[model samples]
Target: MKPLLLIILYCAAVTLPLLASWLVGGPPRPFRHELASGLGILAFSMILMEFVLSGRFKKISTGIGMDVTMRVHQMMARTALIFAMLHPFLYRGTASGGQRPWDPTRQLTITTDFYDLSSGITAFLLLPCLVLLAVGRTKLDYKYETWRLMHGIGATLIAALLLHHTVYAGRYGSQPVMTWLWLVMTGLAIVSLIYVYLVAPLRETARPWRVTSVTRLTPGQWEVTVAPEKHPGLDFKAGQFVWLNVGHSAFSLKENPFSICSAPAAGSKISFMIKELGDFTRTVGQIKPGTIAYLDGPYGSLTVDGRNEPGIALIAGGVGIAPLLGILRELRQTGDPRKVKLIYGNRTDNQIAFRDELDEEDVTYVVSEPTAAWQGEKGFIDPALIDRVFSPLEIKEWLFVMCGPGIMMDIVEDHLITRGTPSRHILSERFDYD
Candidate 1:
């Protein structure tokens, strides 16, 4: 499950169809035409593989981390777009028209069959729109759920079009063996989508969860807890997260991911420290207790369990503290003997959540904009603050787990590297994937 191994497996899956297509016997064609076909095959294969990559498979996300998995998904989509864009242009020198009796194999003549060519044209147009919308999702005015639904539907349509075009028009794909392979691969991609929306929702409907309590932790932050109804609670590691759906059907796309803020040892009720940030999140304060809720997670690889480091360093910015708080509470309730310290940062004093429970002896609360009454550390959670809190030996030897704004994570990670901490020793989760 190491990262390199995952990459190797992924490369094999995406390139397998391309390799097979090339291996199938065919009359010699110009290198440009063959290259075009190969690129098209590779693009479609990569597009289908995107479904598996974005399917939230723990085998992939848990191994390389969700941030890396998502990043790879985005990069591959763009790469596939480039290949798809260039595919047809490279075949310009080949003869194009209706299929001829003389060139039955499509060896010397490109197909001008309207249905076959139309599918390819449709996919080419739709693929760019899908990629552009995804790249600019945050810039547009739309709900995250709305954007998610559009993205899913668009990608599925493009996949179907690409499959039809590949099997019907492709010289290699017209072979019985290649046609079967394309069908199987495309079927698997659709199955992944079905599993997410249909199969998983059906299972969740059987084991429902309900809102147990909602407590205001700060001005804009609330801790909402959900308890299993007639069921044992989720069995998850300390620093994982869940996709929470409150007051929505199990099949709804209104779910939003939030890290578990309460410890597993705290009992069957799991709580999330949510800030008013979006359409769903901004209304968290109004979500009454006893409302129905559905959970689909315990995802992410941010836990420090079983680590051999002598000290554990937790760094957080804003509500990114949710998962870290779970880790901190777990370490305490279990009476973990390892030395632990926390550096929680915020822009203003009132933004810090769960301040009462944080053991002042080990927690450093940093505020960039402190009121006159402020007494704790002032300024950003930068290298200077980090150096002030952690010893040189602890910096190099201890485990560093962090989740926060992208800027803060980058700064902390860069500083950790500068302090000679091994990359493996530093763990981080990104709140905004955009």
Candidate 2:
């Protein structure tokens, strides 16, 4: 779906509970009380939607791109945290008692019922801890898989608590219609989690793959290839990525996201250019050729298949060349007529992968730590290096695709805009989501 429509749908979904609460017709309370309830409703709705956002839904993330999806996921969690914090404080001035003669439903007064109110209190405390943990996930020194599990469990607990609190403690939530709505919405959120962790793995179990090759490319980088065990290979775009689980069950959390360095038309087998960075990746060189594997993907919206740009420029730093290599290989394999140039940068010449395959006529190699005998570009891919390669027209018109460290991407993107390149013409993906 179009991005604007997706955003509109999201806004409508998030606000529906609050709108429904207002339409249910409750006795007028203080402005602060209603505002508190409204904020709570909105926060719960957004929190529920966070499940779908991070659930790896191709329809949602593919439309807006995964980077935007993840960024939105992080930002909205903080927003929901703020709203949840303010929810109880706003009800401070209201009376707390068993049953009031004027308000028999207890709609105007804060309920003293510990059973229903305790859930809200628990959620209010746990929500901040969850957000803080996520914000400091790397600093916590927890394994990514461990962090993912905790994040999921923490989120599920919070969701359950909020659901009970909303249906029982919320003024409008006491209504049967509103209670049912909350149940259905929260059920969908839980189902989203199940679909990702359970359903997707079950589907992948039937179509397994095996490691075909694992060749060391650079000092710490390896090129790993996998072939389908029985079924036809993955049908994906050129620049997409997959969550690869090697030597593990389909349900295992040992999977890691890797870009498909091989083109779609290359063959039935797919290759990934992986750098040894963490626990899973450091062992890439030791993976046996016949190790069983499961792939859950073909994700990412980085391909340029149907774009109308006259020319394309690829910018890469270190192993970030993986997806760009896929695109370049596809263009060549399909005999694409569009002009293409690659500005591949690394710390040294030894770090450059596919040196024998990179077309000399089209590639510009930049090494930050070049040898004394080296003669290629000897600096970073900054604005000066970028300007030295493309002309004014090319800089402004050609499509620029990049993937690298956050700093390099930011520098290149800022320079592209400074060179009069429209924002639409510059596409980038970051390797580090944290």
Candidate 3:
């Protein structure tokens, strides 16, 4: 589906509960009380929707690029946190007591019952902590897998707590129609989690892969190739990535996203150029050639399969060259007539991967900290290097696909825009959403 339609659907889904609550009319309450209820309803709905926005669903992520989808997820999460934090405070001045005989719909008095309020209190305390941990995950001293597990568990617990609070303590939610709506919404959220952690793993288990080779490309980088055991292998575009689980259980959280460095035309075998960063990546060189593995993707929107641009510009920094290499390889294999050029940058010349293969292409090798014997472009892949590499007409007309460090991408994107390149022609995927 198109991005605009997906966005429209997302907005409609998130606001469905609030619209339903408003339609289920009750005795009129003060604006403050209604506002509190509305905020609470919206917050709960958005939280439930976060499961789908986790970037696991291809329908959502593929249409809007994984980076864009993740950015939306992060922004919406913070927004929902704000709404939830203000929900209870807005009801402070409203009447609160046991259910009164006259207030059948609980319009005149808010519930003070321990059972109804306990869940809300607990969720209120936990919500901020969850958001804070997520926002500061990279800075925290924990494994990525550990953070992922904690985030999943914490979100599930909070959702359950909020469900109880909303259906029991909420004035609008207490109504039968609204109660049913909340229950259904929460059920879907749980189902989404199950689909990701359970169903997907089961499917991956059935279609396993075996490592064929592990070749060191640089001091800190290795190329790991895997072939499907019996299946025909992944049918993915050239520049996509997959969640690779090597020598681990299908359901393990040890999997990490790695870009496909091999072209789709390169047969059923797939290759990933991994850098030794941290966590699972640090163990890439240690992995044996015949180890069992599972793949749970082919996700990302960094391909140039059907573009009509006159040329293609590939910009890379460090390990970001993985996906771009796949694209370049596919273009060469297909005998594509369009012009292609690559600008690959690294901290040092020794850090560049696939030197023999890349040297065969129209590549500009750049090193931020070059050795005395180093040649080619020096310094980072900045505006000056970009201007030196491509002509003004090429910058405006060529399709630019980049993946790299956040700062490099930011600089490249800004320069591309400044050089009269339309946003639609500039494509990038980020490793870090923050």
Candidate 4:
């Protein structure tokens, strides 16, 4: 689906319970009480929807790009946290007691029962912790796999807590129709989790891959190749990525996303150029050939397979060259007639990977910390470098695909917009959304 349609569906899903509660008419209550209930309903619904927004679903991630999908997920989580935090406080002035005989609809008094309120109280306390841990995950000492597992489990617990609290304590949610709505919505959320963890893994177990080679390209980078064991290789376009799990079970959480550095036309074997950064990545060189691996992707919208632009401009910074290399190789293998230029930037010359191959193309190497013998561009890949590499016509007419540090992409995007390049003409993916 397109971004607009996905957004429309999201708004409809989150607000469905709120709308159902409003439709399930009851005795009128104070405005503050109704507002509190509405906020609670929306927050619960948004929390449930976060399962589908985890960027594991191809239909959502492929449409908006994983970076945008993840950014949306983070923003929505914080918004739900804010709404959840304010839900109880808005009921301060409302009358609070057990359901009274006088108020059959429970409109005159709010529940003060310990059982009904306990879940809400616990969830209110845990919600902030979950959001804070996610926001500060990089700074924390925990491994990425550990943090991912914690995040998934914490979210599941919160969802269960919210469901109980909403059904028992909520004035509107206590109604038969509203109760069923919450039940169905929460059930769908759980099913989404099952699909991601259980169903996806079961499918991957059938189509395993084996490590073909692991070659060191630079001091901190290595090229790992994998071939399908018995099934046909992945049918993915250039510039896409996959969640690669090497020497681990299909169900293990030891997988990480890596872009395909090899062209689709390069046969069944696929390659990934990985940089030593995190716990799993630092061990890329140790992964022996023929190790069993599982792939769960072909994601991202960074490909240029069917574009009609007169030329293509590939911009890279550090390890961001992986996906762009795939695009370049596919273009060369297919004997594409469109013009191509690559601007690859790194801190030092030795840090550049695939130097022999990149040198054969129209590449401008940019090094911020160049050695004395360095001869190519000697600066960062900023707006200045972009201007020096491409002319005004090329900037406006060419298709620009970039993947790199967030700051570099931001600067380049802003400069492109200022120079008459339409937003649609510029495509990019970022490793960090924050």
Give the Å error, residue 314, model 4: 0.2
Candidate 4: worst-modelled 10 consecutive residues by lDDT: 98-107
- Per-candidate total of colliding backbone pairs: 0, 0, 0, 0
CA error at residue 81 for candidate 3, angstroms: 0.4
lDDT of each: 0.90, 0.91, 0.92, 0.93
Q: Which of the two, 1 or 4, has more TM-score?
A: 4
User: Once superposed on the true structure, which residue ranges of model 1 sit more than 4 Å away at CA?
Assistant: 99-104
**What TM value does model 4 have?**
0.98
Residue-level error in angstroms, candidate 4, position 110 = 0.9
> What is the TM-score of each predicted model, taking all chains together?
0.97, 0.98, 0.98, 0.98
Give the alpha carbon lDDT tens digit for every residue of 31-71 in model 4: 88788888898899999999999999999999999988999
> What's every prediction's RMSD, in angstroms?
1.3, 1.1, 1.0, 1.0
- For candidate 1, the 10 contiguous residues with the lowest summed lDDT are 98-107
lDDT of 1 by residue, 373-425 (tens): 99999989899999999999999999999989898889989998999999989
Instruction: Give lDDT tens digits, candidate 3, residues 34-148.
Output: 8888888899999999999999999888888999899998899999999999999998877688667888656778888999999999999999999999999999999989999
Candidate 4 clashing pairs, residues 3+ apart or interchain:
none
User: Which of the two, 3 or 4, has more lDDT?
Assistant: 4
Overlapping backbone residue pairs in candidate 2 total: 0
